[model samples]
Structure formats: C-alpha cells, structure tokens
Target: MLMAKLMNLVSKMPINPLIGAAGVSAVPMAARVANKVGLESNPHNFLLMHAMGPNVAGVIGSAVAAGVMIKYLG
Candidate 1:
C-alpha cells in the first residue's frame, strides 16, 4: 500500500525504533476503529472479515518493507 512506501521514505530519517513501532501500530488500530464505527451504523451491511482486508494488507506491506530494509541495510 501507499503507506508502506511512505514508511520506506520515512525510514530514511534518523528516528528511533520505538517511534517507528508506534507509527506502525497506529495502522491496525485505525483499521479496527474504522471497522467498529462502520459496523455500528450498519451491522448487516459490512462483515468484520471484509473490513479487515485493508488492515491485513497493511500489516503484510509493512512486514515486507521491514524485511527488505533489514536485509539491505544490515
């Protein structure tokens, strides 16, 4: 996803690993919050698994990016 690309760019900066972790954690939390909000108004319309697709993709994207960074940089 675009966020993964943005994170790759951001990684070029001299940020602490903890800060990077916090930033990454926000993705899943935001996705869950969005899903919860969406379900509240129209529970019959959207399934949890459907809402989770983007979240899972983002997680995978971040993981792949991190792997690439570690492999190349270290």
Candidate 2:
C-alpha cells in the first residue's frame, strides 16, 4: 500500500525532464520509425530521426518548430 502511494505521487510529479530523456533515448528508435514510415528515403534516410518525447507537448512543439524551420529554410 505504501509503495502504491509512492508510485501515485511519482506519477503526478512533473515528468517533463524524464520525458525529454526518454525522447533522447529514443533517437535510434525514431530513426527506425522514420524508416518504417518511409521518411528514410535516399538523402533523408541519413538525416531522419525518430524520438520519444519528455512530454507530449514537448514532442509536438518540437515537431511544429521543425516544420516551421523546414518551411522557411529547408
């Protein structure tokens, strides 16, 4: 019971930093996902990335920002 309560509290804590670490850890995994999705074609294959996020917002915002950069500079 005590363990459960501890876990519950941990779950409610801010996990964004952890999530970011998870995303960083997922770099290789993201490449795999991109390959699976065919984003890994030709030159893109070398630069494509796959990642988990520290949080949903972080990942989504990163993606949006990347898109914007690509739109303007890619």
Which predicted model would earn the best lDDT?
Answer: 1
- In candidate 1, the residue pairs with backbone N, CA or C atoms under 3 Å apart (3 or more residues apart, or in different chains) clash, namely none
TM-score per candidate:
0.48, 0.29
Q: List, residue by residue over 12-35, the lDDT tens digit for candidate 1.
A: 763222222233335666555655
Candidate 2 accuracy as TM-score: 0.29
Over the full model, what C-alpha lDDT does candidate 1 score relative to the true structure? 0.56
Best candidate, TM-score = 1
Question: Which 10-residue window in model 1 sums to the lowest lDDT?
Answer: 15-24
Residue range 12-52, candidate 2, lDDT tens digits: 66322222333433445554454444443444433232223
Question: Each model's number of backbone clashes?
Answer: 0, 5
RMSD of each: 11.4, 13.3
